[model samples]
Target: RKPKTLLAGVSGRARPGRVLAIMGPSGSGKTTLLNSLAAQMDKAPGLVLQGEVYVNGEICNQSMASMRKGYVRQEDTFYSQMTVRETLRFVARLKLSPEVPYEDKMAVVESLIKKFSLAKCADTIIG
Candidate 1:
């Protein structure tokens, strides 16, 4: 039996300084397409993913691609009791370079909160 294809014949380009949004109904292969583009799709048994993903016009291979891309799922998972600020802070601490100073990390977090207009709920529980 052949495995089902989660994505088919999808193609596009994302240029620098330009924002791209993927919108579709549930189960419409939106996540699948993003995962394929980011090269983060799960390697499940009997699953085969085909097609090429390119970055800056270069093919995005394991060694050639920098793992700096971020993917936020439709259903975000975080500590329900932790405030948004705390959640962002924790993620920054974990994902940011160790050489990045504490103040710089905090500054980045603050910038992100402001940029995303998250200040209204920065101290509210993520849930």
Candidate 2:
């Protein structure tokens, strides 16, 4: 079987204190590139994934990328009936490692709430 290349020759810069958005039509490998950069891409048979990710000017491997970076999907897949905190907790439970204790996950959720300045709306329902 022939191997398919999902992304190649893709390069860009992301400066701190700024927002970087990857925009493209559907099936253009935006998610693929993001997963590769965030080290979240799952391995598949015959998949030859090769790339170097750098954060804060230092080269990072998969584990390093996991620790230093986070990815928020472009779509709004959360339930509108859930409050802000509920939504965050739900996602945290899904994304954080299973070995992470419940208390720890909640702590991380709280940290994210504060970091993103969502405390005021923590209990506000998404309408």
Candidate 3:
């Protein structure tokens, strides 16, 4: 569905194992829509979302239920000279389940990149 604030009333389901891109000009509420979905900011002034945000058919609000579904913001942050692996390792260390094996985690990470078609630049340095 389109965002409740700017892209309101637009509706569609994002399928698993695929990509969804929202294209628009500046001020088209693209970022605003993301902010709403992420719950990163309060609704503008008096705005409100009238329905539940579901993950796998379960509602998610206030505290995001699916922590494994990571959010990568538009503003990229990189530590100087850190390779992509190092940066991702650092992030996975801080964010991923430490109980999970490293190979498993790496596999999951790699799978995500492959599904997103990000392999061409997978090893490139972020900064």
Best by TM-score: 2
lDDT (CA) per prediction: 0.81, 0.83, 0.68
| Segments of candidate 1 deviating more than 4 angstroms | 43-46, 85-124
Number of clashing pairs, model 2? 0
Per-residue C-alpha lDDT of model 3 across residues 1-127, encoded as one tens digit per residue:
5644445574457787777787689888776666666776474665665666665566775566436454566676777577666666677767788898888878777777778887787778776
TM-score of each: 0.59, 0.63, 0.46
The superposed Cα distance between candidate 1 and the true structure at residue 23, in angstroms, equals 0.8
Candidate 2 lDDT over residue span 1-127, tens digit each: 7778898888788887788989999999988888777665673344557766667667785567657555796677889999999999999999999999999999999999999999999999987
Q: Which sections of candidate 2 miss by over 4 Å? A: 43-47, 54-59, 62-67, 75-77, 88-117
Superposed on all Cα atoms, model 1 deviates from the true structure by an RMSD in Å of: 5.4
By summed lDDT, the worst window of 10 consecutive residues in model 3 runs over: 61-70
Task: Give per-residue CA lDDT, model 1, range 1-127, as digits (tens).
Answer: 7668787777787666677899889989887787676665673355567767777777778875566666676666698999999999999999999999999999999999999999999999877
Better model by lDDT, 1 or 2?
Answer: 2
